[model samples]
Target chain A: MENVLNWITANQQIIYIVVLMIFVGIEVIGRVPSVLHTPLMSGANAIHGVVIIGAIIVMGKAETDNYLALVLGFLAVILGTLNVVGGFVVTDRMLEMFKKKK
Target chain B: MELNLLTLCYLIASITFILGLKMLSNPATARKGNLVAAAGMTIAIAGTIFLYEQDGEKLHNYAWIFGGLAIGGIIGTLAARKVKMTAMPEMVSLFNGMGGACAALISLVEFNHLSKQLAANEVEISAVQPTVLIIVLGLLIGSVSFAGSMVAWGKLNGRVKDFSFTGQNILNLLILLVAIVAGVILVLNPGQPLLLYAILGLALIYGVMFVMPIGGADMPVVISLLNSFTGVAAACGGFLYDNKVMLTGGILVGAAGTLLTILMCKAMNRSLQNVLIGSFGGHKTAAVAGGKQQGAYKEISLSDAAMVMSYANKVMVVPGYGLAVAQAQHVCHELEKILEEKGVEVKYAIHPVAGRMPGHMNVLLAEADVSYDKLMEMEHANDEFKTCDVVLILGANDVVNPAAKNDPASPIYGMPILEVELAKTVIVNKRSMKPGYAGIENDLFFQPKTSMLFGDAKKVLQDLCAEVKTV
Candidate 1:
């Protein structure tokens, strides 16, 4: 565990760069087949649950000087999570309109 | 105490964003998406404040940040609560504009910080190079989004000239020139406050100008496209602050917006170029030929029309924009109640794009608490209309246009329509014989099986409902 921590400490910046870059790559290439854009967009909107994750991380790891940041970040994430959950449910109901009859 | 709780929160917030996005496909689940996404955003914002330490110099006007968020949140909530559903497209434009403006403002504040440090000869300020890039990009896109959104709002509200102003486009061009000239000044001296304000100001003007010429019928497309721009601007702000959440949120909006724009094009049966250059749908030359004497159908009094419908075995109601204009949803509901009581089977036939905007009729019907089962989509209701004893049209046209049947030259050609004419007896209520948005007369009004009852839609419908009860 100690050795792993040391290696991670040394490579933190690179790791940040790599993860951020992958997200960017997804953004640039995230084309839903022309047929699936509406569905895909709705699907992707559901994934916005990450905002909640972001808020939690900020609040839980807050320092003494970052009290306000912690509160604001948590608030933003909670609101963002509600949006994701509601949006996904709505999207599924919408997609049902397109289902084929057996 | 030194836990990686912030990182975990960020991961959760990101997942919420994804979930919201997935749920946004259907209107029914859209609320859940919003709730979840809002929860995620709250979490992300809180995390930023709590988890992130201030290793660098803190911002001086953090209070202003909180103030802006509060004010924006209040205004957004008020608009959502107060605005009519019909006006939702315009309201969306207003919200999107606000988002862009916020991004631009935040970038400006950051830029100011960077320049102040540079002027003080602080060696640490050298690290602000990426901040400079983000600032410029944010200003450009945000200004456009803000201005464009306002113009779109105006167009949807049908006050084009008020938003466009006299010679607005020309003035916008001049502003762009000034901004370009200011850009050179900015490049020559990166710390010029005057230049910063100038370029940002010009960019804002350019946004309005770009959106001004667009017409009302294309508002959905315009708003969706601008939504994409707002997203990009937000992402740019994310880049400025090195915030992962902002980047992700911005990218998602941008991608979603582009996709929406494409869908809007399909709705209009045109390309993006056509939408931009084709003027709007409301005032095109009449798509169907008129002025030739349409055969006159028999006119019916309220009493006679009521008698015909009261005893009908099956009655189908085809609603159009006129029903909306007349605010007759309540009356229609009343009429339905009366008819159903008489053992008459009643159903509402709706077109895909019936009203000015998509699903306009559906929302109006939903508001009246009309039973979902009673409301039938066009395809489902078409064949049923043929066997019906009477088909009552309450202030509707265009969708009943026979132009789709025989004339391929019609603008609405190839679009599917409800065959109200298929009914054994048809009653059409309109104030005048004037044509619809396409400026084409309704041939269904003149057919043998159809009867025209000219009057106010709501009042006439009420009269019919009362008369149907007595009959």
Candidate 2:
């Protein structure tokens, strides 16, 4: 419990950012018309693909001799890249359909 | 100095995500918003690749990283571009699943690293307890999102059937509890690779079981919920790495997805808990409701239907998943144009939960170049129905079902539906008398004012278009 508290204190800035971002998310998403729900969802899905950065960091830092870390990191990179690229591309396609209406 | 530059890149990425999501709320700026965010993502990635260093050692293994990126990028782009509009809901589910899998894999890799560090006596168990908790959480939630989304994708595409047994909800709860308990134990112990894998296995089962019983009509809510789960899991990765861009993006998605889930449930007049546990559209309800009698319905000839729509002052078309299944949106749009050319006003009535996903019908109509102004939401459409001369229902059932309003014993009772009955005439196009995705019998079909025009939606719309042109 003490360690948890210390960790919380140590990461206070991150916690604050998370809390503030949550509010911003709700406020922004609340105004989206139902017509754009699917696209908005697809866009959000793409945003979370930021995890690819973590994948890159891990794969970069892992020692070449460490087979387990290297393999898992490689897989993570692939999946994360898929998430990032696929998410954005799919979202863009969905949104493209919406744009021609104007 | 280099770290500060990377942090600046992350900060720029975070701001663009917010700006992008903000612009997405408006149709005119939505496409641009997406591009801006993608650009920011590229900047973040470039900064991380060149500027990020750990202990004065920059990242290596460029060949492996770029190879994976290139392969995933090709597959993802091809799949997204080639997918049919009708297959969009499942495509989103499939892509979202990949994200969840990535998050779970990150947790696995990080946990392995932590275990190694602990073994080398480089990290204290007490100091790393919180990190372990986050890793366990990321693994559990990410695995569930991945597995559940796959099942949802399969269910959406008709490859998986809704399956539930007696005590299934109880069993689901038990599995989840066991997984959480195992996660807690792993957190406390810090180095049990076996225990971590066991939790992953349990979470995968829980995810599959969790989605197995949810009926097709309820997929929007399930997909949204799972989307949020993936977001939160990704946020856990951010927490582990202290990456501000990742944290912001993940939290934003988590919040957005959660709100969308609640909105979907509200649109159906259901609570989130009810959606998760009730499995409202499963076979059990279908069997019980099957015994009820539906009075005889009248059939409308295509020419007569065309005549009725041609003479009407205002025509409102209600579309559903069946229209998508028949790939009839283009033909339906053609019919609308023909009707309008005859001096009849044409508009579309879109139910909130229509089709497989939220705003699904709108996307279909938009693809066919239906003007956005002509599409009316349920509340506005309900008002318009009072003055509407004819309501042309194209492959829609439950959304226009009177049972939602009138029959208390109905599984979809209390759910809001388009009051198409308020119109002077209702022409329903269906292949047969089969129930809708919810498997509930629609009482509106038998009403005196309703006429069933039985045929495939696309063929019927095409014939209606030809007939309307003549009239």
Each model's fraction of native contacts: 0.03, 0.74
Tens-place lDDT digits, model 1, residues B352-439: 6566555566666755667777778777798688889999887778878877777776666765678777789999988888877656
For candidate 1 chain B, the 10 contiguous residues with the lowest summed lDDT are B56-65
Q: What is the lDDT of residue A98 in candidate 2?
A: 72
Question: Model 1 chain A: which ten-residue window has the lowest total lDDT?
Answer: A48-57
Q: What TM-score do all the candidates reach, one by one?
A: 0.75, 0.95
Best by TM-score: 2
lDDT of 2 by residue, B43-156 (tens): 888888888898898999898788878888898888888988888888888888888988898899899999999999999998888899999999999999999999999999
Clashes of each: 117, 0
Interface RMSD, in order shown: 8.0, 1.4
Give the docking tier of candidate 1.
incorrect
- How does chain B score by TM in each prediction? 0.85, 0.94
Candidate 2 chain A, run of 10 with poorest lDDT: A93-102
Task: Put down candidate 1 lDDT per residue, A1-102, tens digits, no spaces.
Answer: 996697578657644643564354245324333323333443443332233332333334334464454445434433333333433443344344333323
